[model samples]
Target chain A: MENLYDVVIIGAGPAGLAAGLYSARAKMKTLILEKDKAGGQIVTTNEVANYPGSIDDATGPSLVARMVEQAESFGAERKKDEIVKVELQDKIKVVTGEKDVYKAKVVIIATGASPRYLGVPGERELTGKGVSYCATCDADFFTDLEVYVIGGGDTAVEEAMYLTKFARKVTVVHRRDELRAAKSIREKAFNNEKMAFIWDSVVEEIKGDGIVEKLVLKNKKTGEITEIDAPEEDGTFGIFPFVGYIPKSELFKDFLETDKGGYLITDPDMKTAVPGVFAAGDIRHKSLRQVVTAVADGAIAAVQAEKYIENTFEN
Target chain B: MVILEKDNFEEEVLNSKGLVIVDFWSDGCEPCKALMPEVEALAEKYEGKVKFCKLNITKARRLAISQRVMGLPTILLYKDGAKIEEVTKDEAKAANIEAMIEKHI
Candidate 1:
């Protein structure tokens, strides 16, 4: 028989975990389903200084470990299963996973977002070898080495600054003449001695043999192409792409209302247009998508879910 | 404590007094992201009188499916926690949302 739950949460990221914590603590039979490993984006991040009341030594994994422990302690059952489909119209919600099918009275979603990559040559092959999307994860490997950063956004500029702590020098390459980052961050990058800019430029291709050894740069304004060789001392360098992120919501395209870029919408209470559905975390269409905000969304979603079950299913 | 899961969202919001507005959106939706500030503005504008919230479909696929949301950026309005109106993509403008809130509040 399929085990029935009071709440079934998708994804084990901060939002999902938070929802699990709140729901289970409220005495709801909650189950958290994660497609892969838990921790979400925090697993790839190195430092987490912004979370309020967080420990000073809190790294991404460390914080997530604590959250997981907390949620488990509160009686939230977690399983590693990819949800394939769902039947949510009835009073009881059914979630079908790759391994098993489960039922729940309520569901919370917190899948989070995935990194967007530059689809250039050698990118897919050289990932983790020399090419990376997160500077915090790969910065230590490139101590005193030169690094190239793509994009002109706040994340790009901030990551470039973070890279300066380990990299010998950091070069920012943008397709436009000017950076699109905030003025303060741009000013900080400008003042940093280790930071340099390649304006009106785009990375046409990433080339290397087993590792990144050279880059093919294209001047957008002038259309000039040049192959910049890696420094001889290191034989190779790191390339960090800070282009953007795409939400992992392909499975939901058919049912959910999405925007042009495919983000999900929600009201302030985290409820969907449909009577019994709710959403939360980075997956929601929100302006700021930090860890703090995701956790907040989870807490709110859990509370709402509790009330939903109590009133409608009390009979 | 409130648990905002799929089963209980309707009861929680509808049972509460005053206007209840729900924004349905997803990640990777540019226009949805663009309209966030406007939604937040509405939340702030009607803070004391109205209750506002958001639902992400990508993360909450089951919930979205249950609700029968068919597109990006749908909004729902509830009075006393029962859904009274649904705002389609074309009707998701701030003016319309505001008008809906005005009717309930």
Candidate 2:
């Protein structure tokens, strides 16, 4: 088709931006479509430590800004569009954003996942007030306040420990009697004086006025419900849930091979079961979900897309 | 882009003859800072069709309070003199802003 881009990348996080950079560098016509800001979830993060070769004391926004500049400098065009549909059954794929439609030879899916919510009452309304998913973003707001963290996974426990640095006390409320986090992480949480745990329990509701004031917890073993109020003089408390993430793969479910959790399944080369279509970042069914891994996935998907186009259409 | 103040809130936004988008932001709000570039870009693209403006809450706290604005980076879409939609939390996203514009203007 006329004016078809070589690769159209969905989302503008590290993975999508990296793919754009690689595809553009390979002399392919690339366009990166982002539903939100350029940085994705990383923009909410205040600091990043683990990414290799990152500058000392690098912030998440700073890191993402540099990556985006590099990608655009290499000739990747970026646009803001909320994609509503996709037609992936043909050699040349069709992707529809709310504002525009696009045709592409290859499509890279990197619409990253978001943190899973607890689905309890008041949780949604109190999100920015006192409920948060990322401690890195909202921890400082809760300094010296009592906080409750819900989950048993590595991220939950790890974040609980991290919150102790800001909150006066952090109580971990998990569904099971024990934690599912790594042993080392568990040890750190148990030893911390500011950290505590509520076993075999789940939060039934989060109640607050203009801010979070109380939580209703249910003891799974005893079938008892109890109300935990914010400490006197505090008037409100913080609730941080780190249950896990839900992949942003609803639009591609019928077209691409995906795991039960809705994460797109891709080969090691980032190629999906459908030829010329690839998946990357947290949307991919992979182990690590960090900036480093996302960048690597993006690079591979672009290079693979380039090879696919060269072999199929060019020569 | 219009810089909204307490005195011009009515004339520039409410009493305007066209569709208007007023971004209520603060100086140190990181998300607001992150969204300004996108807002500026959209202002250029939507110039003459839709009005884009900003009001610094730090300078116009009374106007912000009068509008019941509880958070930073709140984007309000106004059709003529009536406020139609408000994006309070995820207003930093350009797509979300664009979708609102597409839905109305």
Candidate 3:
């Protein structure tokens, strides 16, 4: 007989860890399955200042460590495995991973989302050397140096603002004349002292030897091309792209309800169209994709999973 | 525990009272995995009042195709055994789902 769990959570991110903590504390046989290491997107981030009630100057890795510790202390069993298939139609949901198969009465999904890249030249080659997608992670490396941010949305602007704290100068490079970020965010960007704009331009090439040293920029309006060089002494600059993110929903595309961008759908209680299966975090379509919100979703999902088990199992 | 088979989905949904939310999902979808908890929470919160269930396309591929589910994490809302609303995966949020339930309930 397969080992049965009261609740099986996918993805060991903030949401999944929170769910595990709640479910395990409730005395449920909770199992959290992660494809890779724990921490999800938070691992990629350098620091987290926005999470309410967070520790002062809490780094992303530190935050994740605390969450993992909390969940484990509550008796949430975690396994590093990738779930390859599922049988959720039955009363006992079956999840199959790369190595084993397990059964659970309830399932919680907190797989989260991944950053989308421009797929332009040198972007992939110079990822860690000078190109980065997370300002929090790479900002400190560019202390007193110049950095360029791509895109014009909320994330792009927000990251640029965050980068300004460390960088000597921060320039936002957008292909559009007007920013697509929220009004308040745009106002902040416009007001920031260290922030500069490269409007109606796109990065045609990210050129560097070992680190990012120069960028070939193309003006969208005038079709003019120019090579922006890194400041002397520093010898290199940083590039952070914040265009958008792609939700990891390809596996469930055939069955689950998804939007054009492939985000998952869930109800207030986190219920999907199917019973016993729930979703939370960045994977679900929502306005805010933050750690605090993901933790809240995990808490709600755990409580709901308990209810689902009681309703289904109790006579 | 209710054992839902392919042949009994319609009967189970129709016989149930209040609202019924169905999740159509498959394996290998990260977003589907992420949304699972929210769906479960909703089902638990409205356990008696609403029917919450998930359909795995990997197991019920024919049914999923019949329903014309083109994407993952598709949520269909049913009230009194009748289809009321359909929400795409990206639009499936607690607030949005609550609004739909409020409209029907």
RMSD per candidate (Å) reads: 21.8, 4.8, 20.4
- The TM-score obtained by model 3 is 0.67
- Give the better candidate number (1 or 3) by lDDT: 3
Candidate 3 lDDT over residue span A111-203, tens digit each: 889889888899776775578765543455667889899999977887899889878999999999999998988999999999999999988
Backbone clashes for every candidate come to: 53, 0, 53
True lDDT of residue A140, candidate 3? 51
TM-score of chain A as modeled in candidate 1: 0.90
Best by TM-score: 2
My TM-score estimates for the predictions, one after another, are: 0.70, 0.80, 0.67
Model 2 stretches astray by more than 4 angstroms: A1-3, A161-166, A183-193, B1-31, B38-86, B91-105
Could you arrange the candidates by lDDT from highest to lowest?
Answer: 2, 3, 1
Model 2 C-alpha lDDT per residue in residues B28-65, reported as the tens digit of each score? 35567767888899999999999999998766754664
After superposition, candidate 3 runs with Cα above 4 Å error:
A46-49, A178-192, A231-235, B1-105
Higher TM-score: candidate 1 or 2? 2
| Highest lDDT scorer | 2
